[model samples]
Target: MRGVVMYKPGDVRVEERDDPRIIEPTDAIIRLSATCICGSDLWPYRGAEPVDHQVMGHEYVGVVTEVGSRVHTIKVGDFVVGSFFASDNTCEICRAGYQAYCVHRVLMGALGTQSELARIPLADGTLVATPGHPAPDLIPSLLAASDVLGTGWFAAVAAEAGPGKTVAVVGDGAVGLLGVLAARHLGAERIIAFSRHADRQALARYFGATDIVEERGPAGVDRIKDLTGGLGAHSVIEAVGTQEAMMQAIHATRPGGHVGYVGVSHDVALPGNELFMSGVHLHGGPAPVRRFLPELINLIWNRTIDPGKVFDLALPFDRAAEGYDAMDKRAATKVLLTL
Candidate 1:
């Protein structure tokens, strides 16, 4: 089987590896159809995160080729979308819609979805099959639901965005941009996206943002407050996990507003006094995508939302290196790898 491996930081290779097998009874072998690199993947590629000489890439959609005897909900030939965290649906966390925190969790990137094949453990609980079979048009939404969309949705939900609420989005990465769309779909009355880029700003408007702020840090917070009649937004989505973005989100909301944060957290340390004085509700972490997959699929199937707009660059799986480079250089909002 062919796979992309990161031998070390800045060194990524598409090479051949022994095909994976059912090492556990709950495993299921799958043939990947589409997969893409994620913004979070950059953390390791840039050497900020540890890079072991192992496989890379996580977001994927595939066809099941084999299922263990213990797996009954899914069988061979089923096309499915699995969460980054392999979980048992019946577990307490999963039952509470927090499968990403399942008692037994398997990180998706470690499983390497950027290959011709993959072995999905906890098959019945981790994978969600499309009703019967999904058409090609639905692929992107299914793919998005696996991560970015789910993350954005989680952020919006955490921020408490809903009808009559004024929501402000901080950051313009794929996830941040998608947060604009999620806030709109969730019924926010006003959305302010803080973006300076022409392309991302345009998409933010298309996603229903009523305003765009080009400022950064304090200036941005001031602008948001000015736009919201000095009360700040009722809800704020913090899609960038940096100290600045996190603080901006914390301060961009009303005294009692909620802040939804879904950026892959890094170097963030919030002081107790700051949060206490702000009185802003903060909630978000690795999105439990499993919880949103069903409704996301339904909305996509009905064409209510198109989360796939995040995919700005598409390349064959073999050119995974170029895909990574483009994103690393900020030349692409996201890169989709075609299998």
Candidate 2:
């Protein structure tokens, strides 16, 4: 088997590795059909995380190759979409719709998807079997449901974004684009997107953004307010974890508006006094994507939403380094790696 490994920043390679065998009675092995380069993976790609020689990738849609003794929900030859955070779906936290914080959780990157085959723990809890081996066209959408689509949905939910309310989106990345989609799906009447890039602005419009702000910092806030008739939007989704993006989402929100942020936070620090006066409710973090997997799968299966449209670039799994480089250089909005 071959898997992606990152030796350090600017270095992701495909290396031959031993195939995984059942290590737990609840585990299952998958042969990836499609995987992707996520923004979070860039943290280590850019040296923001102390990544040593480790596997890379948590988003995948694949066929189950084998199953452990206790795995009943998923079986060999079944196609499935699993969450980045593996969880026992029946856990108390999962039952409460917080699978990301399942008492027993495992981050899949420690065992990545950028491989010919990989082992997934808690198969019954983590993997969602599709009705059947889907048409090739559905692969991208299902892959998105694995992470960005789910994350965007979480951001909108956290921000209290809903029908008839004005919403502002703070980033233009894939997650941000999907956030725009989520807000629109949730019934936001007005969607304002902050995007200086024309291509992103176009996609944002396609995703249902009503306005695009090209400014940054205070100017961006003013622009958002200006578009909202001097009042900030009722709900703002922050998809970028930077301080500037966070502050922009906060400052551009109405006094009682909710701010939902799902960016992977780095050095972001919020000013207490500002937040105190802003009167905006803030919530969001790495999404419990597993919680939303079932509903999202339904939406996709029914073709209600096409989140896979976010993938602008596709490459062979062996060319993952090129995919990473393209994303790092801003040449690709999102990359799909074929296995």
Candidate 3:
């Protein structure tokens, strides 16, 4: 089988690799139909995050080719969407809707889904079977549900977005863009998106953002407050994990408001005094993509929302290096690698 491997920074290649086979009674092998390059992947590509012969990619949607003996919920020939974090789905943490922290969790990203075939552990708990083999056009949207859409949905939920709430989103990447969409689906009355890119701003508007603030740091915070009648937003979703984005999220929320962040933190540190003085609620981490997979799949299946628009570029699976380059250079919002 051929898959993506990162030999070092700025050096990702598609090369022959040993094919995956069932190693656990609870595992299943999938022939990937679609996968993607995530913003997080760039961390390693830029050498901000270290890697040594790493198998790349986690977001995927595909057909089950074989199932383990104990896998009953999913089966062969079933088209599915699985979470990036594999969980038993019945664990205490999962029962509490935090499958990302499942006691028996596994980080599927480490195994890599950017390949022709891959093995998925805890298949019954991780994979969600679609209603049927979906139409070809729905593939991109369903693929989004696998990670970016689900993460954005979780961000909205964490931010407490709902009818009558004024929400602000930090960042304008795929996850941030989809955060705008998720907030809309959650019924936020006013969505303020922070973005400097005209294309992203347009897409943000299409996703229901009422305002766009191109400024960053304190100026951006002021802009958000200015748009919210000097009170800032009631809910702020931080989709970029930079210190600047995190501080923007915190400072742009009104007193007693909530700030939900889903960006992978990179050298971020919050001042205890600032947070103490802000009088706002802060909660976020790696999103339990599994928790929201069902509802998200339904929305995509029924054609109610289209998160697939985030994929501005799509390339063949073998051209993953090119996809990575486009994203690394900010030339693409998100890149979809089709098999």
- What TM-score do all the candidates reach, one by one? 0.98, 0.98, 0.99
Best candidate, lDDT: 3
Number of colliding residue pairs in each model: 1, 0, 0
Q: Write the per-residue lDDT of candidate 1 for residues 145-190, one digit (tens) a residue.
A: 8898888988998898999999999989988988999999989999
Rank ordering of all candidates by TM-score, starting from the highest: 3, 2, 1
Q: Over the stretch 1-339, how does candidate 2's per-residue lDDT look in tens digits? A: 989999988899999999999999999999888899998888888888888888988998899989999998788999999988899989889999889988899899789888888899999999999988898999999999999999999999998888889988998999999999999999999898889899999999998999998998899999988888898989999998999989999999989899999999989989999999999999998899998898999999989989898999999988999999999888998999987
Better of 1 and 3 by TM-score: 3
C-alpha lDDT (0 to 100) for residue 165 of candidate 1: 95
* Residue 214 local lDDT, model 3: 90
Model 3, 135-244: lDDT tens digits are: 98899999999889998888999999999999999989999999999999999999999999999999999989998989999999999888889998999999989999
- Indicate the residue-level lDDT of 81 in model 1: 88
Off by over 4 Å in 2: none
Give the per-residue Cα lDDT of candidate 2 at 79: 94
**Which parts of model 3 have CA positions greater than 4 angstroms off?**
none
Error of 2 at 264 (Å): 0.4
